[model samples]
Target: MNSRRATIADVAREAGVSPSTASVVFSGKTPVSDATRARVLDAAAALGYTGPDPLAASLRRGRSGIVGVLQRGPLGIAFTDPVQRTTMDGLADAVASVDASLLLLRPVPGGPAGDSGTAPGPATGAATLATVPLDAAVLIGTIPEAAADVAALRARGVPVVVIEGDAGEGVPRIGLDNHDAERCLAEHVRRLGHTDVAIVTLRSELNVTHDRLGGARDVFPDAPAFATLASSIDEGLRVGRQVFAAGRPTAVLAQSDLLAAGVIRAAEEAGLSVPGDVSVAGFDGVPVDGLAPYELTTMVQPAVEKGRAAGAAVVAMLLGEQPASVTFTSVFRAGNTTGPVPESRGVSPR
Candidate 1:
């Protein structure tokens, strides 16, 4: 036996069958007899052969057989966000059924955004993504500057799919009805007879701002003055503290539950009662930050479904099929966080 890895010829010889038969058994591109299949399996087991090397096979097919997921920032942080993780999981599940691989590409170090363009090594961040030859690429989380890169990829004729961001010119988009979800929350607040509502908002875009409260007014004019900040419970807490300190509104609609929870904490710190002095609502309806006592009034978007759709779109594009774009609506869940305005201001005091 050669010290080198077992090849298809070796498996065929061990199985006492023709090389083509063994190839058919492995590739499943052609059918073979059950007896032949059993023999091939037995031979592969005896020879400690894990079938043909995928890399070699991919090279032979003139394809990488891997889907590159271009994501911004550190891999760890991207996976930490519940929504992100769930979407990735859904994507993996969608690809796993067809035995496709998911390759996570982070910002290349000094490569483009922050990293340099020079290649350091095989694993040198963005260089790995830039140089890697892939069948297709999924721009995860809407790469703003992806138009050029996507155009380059398009030049190579690779199909691109975007998740939760603008897909640029020809790339397909997968996202929820963010504007509608916000409108739903706004309408809910409006119906509660609260007009002078303040907002704690997440940064609208990564490059543009750090936090946003009123800036969302660009998107929602009916919305109240918002405090723009990073989407986190701490940011929420800070915004909540300020609102409470500066004579808070009757009800506050936070961009995320993490922020809303922080607002609740701020309210507690200020000796203000929730729904008693100020009511609050949030987005992304997922339960985080140990929030239990105050059931948040939120819009529950199907985050996992969003991810699954993106993954499915990738699969479809790979198959040379036109996949349709998907948009999901968030269900408005009214909870303890929202109620009617106080008698002192029984009418909406806008």
Candidate 2:
């Protein structure tokens, strides 16, 4: 007999069982008797037949069992941020429950930094959204490219969920009360008699950053503001030095804990004391690796919860359920980094 590719029917015939039984033996969607399973396996081995092709199986089900996580920058650099790491942990936990795997997708070159909402032109890898098979996608942050990415995914009939960024209509968002949280932090400092302040912020292109900045400015309108490209400690250090270059403010409000830690380092290098000479406050209540002997006064946000909500939304969309957008609040945490404004500055408390 001429050699030919073996099919499930061939195996079923050799095993003296129906094709459906043979299929169940491989798919595991239905239980088969031990004797029948053994027979099917023996028949498959004798016929040189492997299990059913994944692509064909997926085609039959109309689902790739893959979830795409659209990130703003290189995965390595993006994962360095503690908030991102924590958020991803929550997302992974939720995605795993649906028996789906995550595919980290990066935008093409010339895109904004990892945390901004601006979208890039195209992806750098062989798999673009237009070509990759994805059951759904989650936008990690607001990027200018978000609207375009959403359009592409929607065109492919893939549902999209956004975390901390606006993707426009019909897209569910997992958001934080950034403005109120920052305002609360601002109020804390204002009550401490801090009038002269400097603000260090993440990329202003992101709505989260914009809202946080706006909240602080609402309380201290004359405060000088510096925007950093990425939410790394190094960027924080650079901006911290600049904030103190001309003149020192009584307090500095950094948009992230890492940035606040960097500002503390800058203050020490400049021979200024933290909280004693210049108070400092930050957002995101995450631990700063090298910030020792000083705890940051910050707004503690539920980073993991934000990610979990996004993941849950993805699962819901995949199930044909419309999940409502969720908004989370942040809690204020007082630490050693902030204190009452120095009384000897010759400036009176507000």
TM-scores for the candidates: 0.78, 0.83
Residue lDDT tens for model 1, 172-264: 788676666776777777777777777776665542122233333434466545554466788888878888777758888787777888999
TM-score of 1: 0.78
lDDT of 2 by residue, 21-137 (tens): 999999898999999999999999999999887788789878887888887766865478899899988998998877778888866554443322224443644455656789989
RMSD (Å) of each candidate, 1 decimal: 4.3, 4.3
How far in Å is the alpha carbon of 343 misplaced in model 2? 1.3
What lDDT does candidate 1 reach at residue 290?
A: 79
Model 2 Cα RMSD, 1 decimal: 4.3
